[model samples]
Target: MLTITDLSLQRGGVWLLQAVSLTVQPGQRVAIVGANGAGKSSLFQLLLGQLTPEQGSVALPGGCRIAHMAQEVKASDRSARDFVLDGDLDLRRMEAELADAEARGDDHAQARIHGELDIHEAWSASRRAETLLRGLGFSDYDIGRPVSAFSGGWRIRLNLAQALMRPSDLLLLDEPTNHLDLDACLWLENWLRRYPGTLLFISHDRDFMDRGATHLVHFDQQKLELYTGNYTAFEGQRSERLAQQQAGFERQQARIAEIQRFIDRFKAKATKARQAQSRVKALERMERIAPAHIDSPFSFEFPLSEKVSNPLLSIRNGQAGHGTAPILTGINLTLLPGSRIGLLGPNGAGKSTLMDGLRGEKTLLAGDRTCGEHLAIGYFAQHQLESLDLDASPFLHLQRLSPKASEQSIRNFLGGFDFHGDEALSAIRSFSGGEKARVALAIIAWQRPNLLLLDEPTNHLDLEMRQALTMALQNFEGAIVVVSHDRHLLRNTVDEFWLVNDGRVQEYEGDLEDYERWLADRRKDDTEAPRNNQVTSNGVPAEASAGEGVGESADDRKARKRAEAALRQKLSPYRKRQTGLEKEMDGLQQTLQTLEADLANPALYDADGQARLKELLGKQAEAKSRMEDIEAEWLEVSETVESLEAELAG
Candidate 1:
């Protein structure tokens, strides 16, 4: 068991935790959740003995082995596999002793060491390390690469693998999914589920928290509150408690108001003077309950484009790659107004390539690319943050984009993203990763583009900011194509998913759950394939024979092309209708969400607010009914489209 008692911690003269207490039992997976700078990482540092608390005690089991995933890894020339294997300190120690014994020509010591190695199963250490690497999205070829060969993101993944390589009684992971793609995130989730140790992780990924967390440690108001379930359960329970607290606060206020009124009316009268004094004393002695405050600091929306064209962008027979080598080929895609697409694939399967192709970044090695006259693209990627002017303030960043815009307007917009006062005018060089990401997003939103291509936009964002982004995306009228590992964002924001796999891009017919199962099947197939058959980034065998139509006759090829065009013509109306229905449903859902939020206001239950409440309730019901009708139509249209596509394939 891990225990913390009276943990009062302060940093830079600011209290992060005050009298925080938590007890975690063995093998419990606890997810620590809070806003950035809420001391979630500080608590981890305390547990790791890197920081001393101002006043507190932390207890761990005697001789407990702790494994922590480092936030950064120093560049090294060491091979990736060797670096991971080094995580197992005991295994390395045993091997070192055996080597020393062998060098000393001590036969008895060598034999004893060999027996210990056998008992420890040290022979399989390399294989186990390789397994960890593979599960974390490293290819067989990458296993032998030097640690310095990988980029910053991939290096973080290696660190995660190293952490997993170590045997531990307690494991600490901070934002483990931040650098991982969806497939690797799923793999890590599965690994954590089977880990026979106490797990304490800090993550903003909701789906990951739901899947792996058996409990939650919430940091709020300088206190750590433990909940006995997953993140979803914590949300539900917290909502209930907040509602109750709000009600109690309202009641207490009403009672206090009544007492104040009594004191005002009877304080001059001798008969009631004693009673008024007693009542004043009672009011002062009454413990006040703080009103529930759950508002997110970040609140912003993508500005609507003044002009948008149908089929804002299109690529025909496109081959996206670097220089002359294609990473993704045979790509045909169209982005229309109101289009919302989420790209799904394994790491390095060219999701970013496709995004770049759409962004007109010279990634198209072959084929025709066209953009509408009114098409305005707002492209956001991780590298964009690096391109930001580090010395400029957020205010300066926006002002540079629009020289004519007034300072007040820019400040107002920045305020929506929680950048206010001095922070807005401060140089971005001192900002954290999350703050920089917010700036990048703010820049994109300031442009008011008709189309958005966001790749991993939520990387360093906290949960509240992520929720804000999701809401903004939902309300956005422009087209969006995003590549993100955040399933919650993908599910709530995108109407369709595109699978960028096997060197081709196609619409994914199922939801995120089905995509997960597809990945599992692909991983299983990869494992079962022959060792000598190297797999490409798209999971295709590198030595595969030939293209499907390699030997086709000219006439047959022409006929096939004609048939494909005919099928597309036939499917066009259904596809358009499906898209239209999805847009309608999205609008109605937004309306319903607005109504729900209004209804959730505490004032809505008051006597004076009954009329407004009734109106909101009616609006909610009507929107929900419209949503149901649209959903039914959407299902029918989707099924018809699927049937037509299946018929064409057959």
Candidate 2:
């Protein structure tokens, strides 16, 4: 359990979190939710003890251990297993001590060493580390890979795996799902559901929070507000609360008007002087509740310069892969104007290759790919940072992309995506992951292309930014070919899907979920359909997940079933735990509601009430601790069930 009292944090002389006091109870999953730059990350830093609050104290329960994971991870030369293996610092130290004792021929020391090994093994720490790594999308083969060889995104995944492996009583994570693909995110959700520790994390991914976090904490304007429920539930409750607050404000205004009337009527009368004076005092002392204002900054729209009646881009009898390694073959499809197409597939399924091919970057052998006239393309690659000149400022990137554009135009474009002032002038090499993403988007926006090819565009964007981007894209009158695993973004923005498997593209009629089912069905199909010559407007194969001569068998079928079932079972408790945590979080929020109400009373700011407020902070900490305990217990139960199931399967 951890407690914070009168915490205040400042960055560059501006208060980020002010007078913040809260508690995190064992076994509770708390989600920090807010718009970008609203102190959510700052709070996580405070909790991690990475940055000390300028004006308060954080107290952890005696003997409690803590682990923290940031939004971005940096790595040198190390494999995934090496990264996770480092998490067991205590184990390594203990082993070293035992080795030294054995070399000295101490029989008692050897016995003690054996006992220690037994205790460490009882925790199944090494096994758990392996499982966590696999869950985060690293294969067994990838376990020994040097960290220096991994792409930045994959390195982040490795960091996540390592963080998860760390043994601690309380775990704090900042945007843990930023780089995870669909499958990995699901696996993480399942793992966290059963983790036997207090959980607190900052994430912009609604699906991630919905799947795991029970309580939502909203940080804004240097203050923290608690909401009891998952993100969706919190939104509902917050809306209702806002409505009530508005109603209360209206009633108070009406009462004040009546009081003013009474004052006007009785001001000249000695008998009514007391009444008039009291009314005046009441008006002066009343603290009106302010309504919440929601604003979106993403508002750029594509200039509908031209329209194509047939497909904007078409492919016929297309085959794509490196050398003879065909990722997808016989691909045929047409991306019509105004169609929002989502590209869905597993990792290493050639989704990226297809996108690059569409952009005319990759050579497509055995396929006729054609682009419509007047097609101006804007691309957002997953490795966008790699594309940027590290030495240039974000403004410079925009300028390079649009040389004739005015300085004001560039700054305005940057500001729209939450980059402004000094941030725009910051070198691309020095920017944060999110900042770089914003800059990349700003560059794309300046070009104002009609055909948008987005590869995981939502990466590094906060929730508000994601929503804003979604809204902006919804209005664009152009073709959108997006490759992403974010279900929510796919559901909201995509009208159709192109599923790639085994060096082929399968066109689907509906959304990503439907495409996923179609892929699943293809896996279940008994008859291995021969490669048909018939191709659609776009040159893509109609089959699913077929690589050239990668034969399937009954064992593969059994394995697929097992994997799918395990995925569902792994996620089940986390889903249930998320629900339970939301309820508990809501209970704790009631205390905050009371505190806010008391604060609204002008009298509560007086000296006596200030002391009482500090006392109330203690109660909040207690509530936080209790919530954490529940989260830890939920994690234990979830993990226990998973371990038992794994044992039975073994």
Best candidate per TM-score, number?
1
Q: How far does residue 53 in candidate 2 sit from its true spot (Å)?
A: 2.3
Over 73-171, each residue of candidate 1 has an lDDT whose tens digit, in order, gives 988988898899888887899889977987998866765665455445464567677888888889866876789999999999999988888878889
> Candidate 2's error at 514, in angstroms?
6.7
Q: Global lDDT of each model? A: 0.81, 0.67
Positional deviation of residue 542's Cα in model 2 after best superposition, in angstroms: 54
Candidate 2 residue runs with Cα over 4 Å from true position = 70-78, 122-126, 240-293, 307-309, 390-415, 418-430, 508-650
Q: Give the distance in Å from residue 207's predicted Cα in candidate 1 to where it truly belongs.
A: 0.6
Error of 1 at 429 (Å): 0.5
lDDT of 1 at 206: 86
State the lDDT at 507 in candidate 1.
Answer: 87
Model 2 root mean square deviation, Cα atoms: 26.1
